[model samples]
Target chain A: MSAPGQAPSAGYAAVFVHEDVPTAEVDRLEALHRPLADSVRDLVDATIRTTVEDEEVRAVRAEVDALVARLRARQLDGPAGVRYNAEGRTWSWGNAVVGERNAVAPPLEVVRDPDGLVHADTVLGAAYEGPPGMVHGGVGALLLDHVMGVAASAHQRVTLTGTLTMRYVRSTPLGPVRVEARIEREEGRKVFVVATLGDPDGVTVEADGVFIVPRWAV
Target chain B: MSAPGQAPSAGYAAVFVHEDVPTAEVDRLEALHRPLADSVRDLVDATIRTTVEDEEVRAVRAEVDALVARLRARQLDGPAGVRYNAEGRTWSWGNAVVGERNAVAPPLEVVRDPDGLVHADTVLGAAYEGPPGMVHGGVGALLLDHVMGVAASAHQRVTLTGTLTMRYVRSTPLGPVRVEARIEREEGRKVFVVATLGDPDGVTVEADGVFIVPRWAV
Candidate 1:
């Protein structure tokens, strides 16, 4: 990936190339990565909840460091920039919200419908908490922003979020939550989108966003 | 931490108790955890960026599984809910934004001042990328939400987000970014906050938020 303020690198440029990657291969890769991400997610939850003695924690840290070194012995050159194939399959495994390999991301999956609406279902666990028994306000925004951003990019056009606003009607309890987004309108390169983050009880947060098709993407 | 729709655990009731914890101990614990978090963060970035062969990847996965098993041999009963002590020290190790133990979290550190204004500086790397060379809009919102939430709760009274609106003036590029938030006004249980996410070049995103001091906290 390109460094901050730098132009895209040759590898990063490869993401925009419209090549044909067989669906089977994409499926295979995702399947492989999914389990790894799941395991890592479990690790995250375990680490946070662990209350071992200080000596035990220290020992675990040493072992974890060794394991990290082993993995880092061989690695990628840089960031996994976005990649899409001609078949309309796009994967951004490094994305903060929905990257399949991102364990830090809440277990979220977003789907867009024929009507240009986006819907998602996710569970926020202890790892995503901010308040005593509620979802972190920003975590709620994170879910809404991604789903609404997808609504603005329904056509598969490259769109960047220009601005977003959210209203938290009530505290979102940690657990199963639903997100929905639909485009309100479009003006030239700007797509206006609206969305919500809610639980089975009702809407907890509302969001409005302006997404821009940047000059470079255009 | 309480599960979805459940009342908080009895221990959570103790947060309001506020007993004195020495500053030195807080500093010591933070120092100990910081390195561990740093290593895990490196592991996360490596996992995403690795481009090794499938065979080697499988081997590494097996080793990682072993490490996870060792760590999980002993664990906590549940979530690490928010905890603070009388010295006005608060620490939420599982926080999504600033939790040192949270590898999935962006390496963000926020500081709130006596004036009820909050300031934070962080670097957005591959782990937080959203656009092509620019920070993801949701990531920007996430940072703003947390800082502004802190701004609203600057007096140490519990406040939850009520509403947030962001105007994306431009795409914030990935790299060093600054966030600032301050209370704009207040009405019965409501605190209005204004904030910005920007780079050295200029402001890239602007936000307004309403954070509510919930009835329970009140």
Candidate 2:
């Protein structure tokens, strides 16, 4: 078998495509898509809690379907791969964590500090619940993993999650939550990171992860 | 701190409410909601890949917003928590993994074997992508954690994920995937479970999880 960051296997280098789109265009696209994603997120929450009659539910479904058809009339044929322009602007609008156009992705706005710490603040609505009013453990992991990846990918280096271990200290209630991650250390191509997911009360989940820069990218 | 199976500070019992809805009515509700979720899932993919003119995209957004308002005309004040009925029927229409009406939840159909194995077959589409065509590593963990919880909760016992560790053997392509879990063992109220997420060719991720039945339930 190949070593940790060796050749002979698949890698994500291809997904990081270089497009010629200008930085201003990228920002404009993000501005346009972010609101659409917000609307979709609201739609998801409303769908979960709707108490309308069956007829009303069915009518809403029809209208949603019609809107989807309108959007599909002109669309890309596949997933939105990560793209960057010569001006150093990057976008991945289909990403499952912070994609501007992905409604299923939690609307996480991540900020990378000058010291390399990465953090985000987002509200987990009804659509993210696992237990009664708490955020699903898996969803918590998902958010942590993404934030940790962002931390590891600082300095424009591409990295993929190698291993992740999450400890659920307590339940995270559905509402405003904060996730923070920072690099603990690095060895060769692997970066070790630590993170936490917390509600207003305190920390709920602590996570440690290893991220590796693939050989091909290197 | 409370012992593993002793009096607890927080438990899921309150969420597993005993509502007196009939099983037939639950089935009817599921039938009505599942189709809407499927359509929403489709819309998510379309939104991610759409290349329509900016005007068309804004028009779709307006229509989608209208639909959301219609659904919000009458709604529950809070989340749709887990509810069970007199006939031993349970429903959690807002669950992040298996909620019938949850558009953000992946459309997973889970099954339990008589021998205590839990499995699910689902298709991961464009919206689930993290790295180009591959499933997000966190999404893999989310699926494995849910399936392992199902395995741990066999025999009508409720379990919450206490800790989860995931090893991404390889990147899973976005397509047909199968997840399977089985109880590895049990100690007191803690159930140890193992699970895998795989594409058609082979396993792409392996996971080990500890699920705890909260103290109050015991």
Candidate 3:
């Protein structure tokens, strides 16, 4: 099967999954909707880092909630767990942290290169703030956890985040940023991965994680 | 240092941080009046898994907001991080996953044995449901993560969850339950820990985690 996040978004350049009805097909939507998904992802990081005002927050929340309600009205039973296409491409759009169609999700899409290295770009808006004008440490970990989870999976083994360690080198300003993750090593059921979240100015948060295929799952 | 969870409230036996604040220490008399912090913790879990009515939600929100405003009147500059006393007691009352005084916290208290084994017991009620009367998987993870983080620390090293792997063995029912954790191995900056959450009936969820000391922190 094609890997998750490999397919493209359709008609909308910023929104990933359109309201098209569910189809019997698997990989079809990815080719049509990746670009839009990519844009929304940027919106997420930007929102977290934005110095927007209360009025803006109200406006954004209203818009977001409306969008959420709209999607909810037509959703398939629950969240979109990872889905694989006819060609083996995987898509998980209803995910709270990484779903493309999910506006509530900070539009994160991890891109895997030929060497298996993973890099992603997204925006953090004001909504994700913990310390005023800065991204919450937990939110940073949440984002890192997913990216690192991807690295551990290597599109091979089905792995879960086993442990994550993060060092806040500095408070992350809410705004545009880049995320990079790489595999460190492997031992039995565990995989070690290192990753970072940074702005154009420089790196702000760095993380290392151990992901595992549980003894039972293995 | 002495472990936390030795407070005076009997209702708090299910929680870890049981230190009682002389009601005199608190400026706002009412916030401390409703219930002991430990019982409040149970209230929170119950709230999450509750089947309360809409009117109850409205009433609770109003009361909660008033309490919040009152607490804010006599507040620290921000959310509580982690605190410890000269007596070697540590308390994190504002942690989203597990904070002792936090009414919003699941109100979990994990105890460690001399052999390094860790165990926790909590009552899940109306507020934590995911499916029909079942505890949400994510909540289960949050509780497990903290317990394992404590296990990995074992008082010597501070660790952040680097990865987490969970298997939903079955739907967790809302009620009294137990959690147990133990270290599996340690390598460099990472510690592997395993845990389980279950009701009186049977094991419901199992987890493995990788806790890490950031390269910089270690």
Candidate 4:
């Protein structure tokens, strides 16, 4: 499984490796990968909310690192910079916390159903704790930004997070949680998106963001 | 050296930290701390854009970490939470990126002059880079959020980042830069602040924000 990326897969650049599958074949495998991505997303939430001990953290880190090395054996150049195929499909797999093919990303794979509903389900675990048993505020923002950005981008054009506002109604406990995002408005290069993060206890975090397609972006 | 706090220090905290101090004595040190804070703010921008090498990073990290451990030893329990004394003094050093006592923070000490002009000078180094030589976009937001929040709170009451917006007018090169912010308007708990990040080549980034005082805050 020793594949080569346009960028070499060693030394300083190894940190950015992710599986680069051929575009034409992804459509055939999307059905299978989608479910696995969901499971990985669960692992992320679990890592963030876990009350596991130091010994467990060590165990998990080593296991994760080993997985990272195996994945490194086959990789692409740098991160999955926003790429578009001849068929107009795009994917980013080296995203910090939730890139497909990014082992470090908690198996999150956002799926936009025929109805335009954007939803993600994932588990919380040990690595993401902030206030003991709760998810970190910055981490929440990261996930929200990605999902909300996805809603804004809608696979149409490139966009950057121009602005984001979050209201933490209550402490979000670590466990199975669902996220939903939808477009609210669009003006010029900016698209406004709204999202909600919830556990069993109703909604814990509500977010509104303005994502901008940079002036230079096509 | 560890003499509680003077009136001026509390006043400076009121200025940059934006919280109240229990002792009126904080006012006595405000004059001294404010200027010191301003210079330190310059340090932050310099560190972010520094062309320094690995040895410098290790040296700086060691000194910074040692100082952090020392401050930890002296403090009651972390930075003073946002609070107000009868005289209306407040401090919050737990802030990411700019808190005085936070080791992880780059140098950021804001100065709120009597005219209410918000001026900051800082340095950026390798650690803060996102695009090789440019400061991380998120880090820019963090610093801007901080000084802008102080502008909203105005050392009078509690304020949190409610909404923040940024424009990357150009690629902000790593180096020394200056930031300036001022109140644009206000509505109840919502305060509007605007700022710019600049080098000798004019402003590279501009920002506008809406900072809010939580419903519970007076």
Model 2: pairs clashing at backbone N, Cα or C within 3 Å:
none
**Worst lDDT 10-window in candidate 3 chain B:** B1-10
Q: How well is each residue in A2-92 modelled by candidate 3, as lDDT tens digits?
A: 1124333332122223233344443444433333334333333332223333354344434434333432333344223344444545555
Tens-digit lDDT track of model 2 for A1-218: 01111112245445567778899999998888778888888888888898889998887788888888888888888898777777767777888888889988986888988988899999998888887787888889888988888888775667878889999998898999999999999999998999999999989999999988777656
Best of the candidates, TM-score: 2
Query: Cα lDDT for residue A98, model 3?
Result: 58
How do the residues A130-159 of candidate 1 rate in per-residue lDDT, one tens digit apiece?
765467788888788888877887765667
Each model's DockQ?
0.44, 0.56, 0.04, 0.05
Cα-based TM-score, every candidate: 0.86, 0.93, 0.46, 0.47
Clashes of 1: 5
Q: Candidate 2's interface RMSD, please?
A: 3.8
**Candidate 3 lDDT, B1-218, residue by residue in tens:** 01222222232223333335553343333233213334333323322223234444344434433333333333344334334433445445445445433333445667889999998888864444332244544456556656766787775554555556666576566678888889999998888888887889877778777776656445
In order, the Cα lDDT scores of the candidates are 0.72, 0.81, 0.53, 0.51
The runs of at least 3 residues in candidate 4 whose Cα sits more than 4 Å from the true structure, single-residue gaps closed, are: A1-158, A162-192, A196-206, A210-218, B1-91, B160-162, B187-190, B212-218
Q: By DockQ, is 1 or 3 better?
A: 1
lDDT of 1 by residue, B105-177 (tens): 6657778677667899988877776765567677888889888887887766666677788887877777899
In model 2, which runs have C-alpha deviations exceeding 4 angstroms? Answer: A1-13, B1-10
| Candidate ordering by DockQ (highest first) | 2, 1, 4, 3
Question: Candidate 4 residues A1-218, lDDT tens each?
Answer: 00111232133143322345566665644443433333333333233223334454444444434333433344332323333344435444333334453323454567777766687888654333332244534445556756776787775555666666666666566677778899887887778889987888788778887777656544
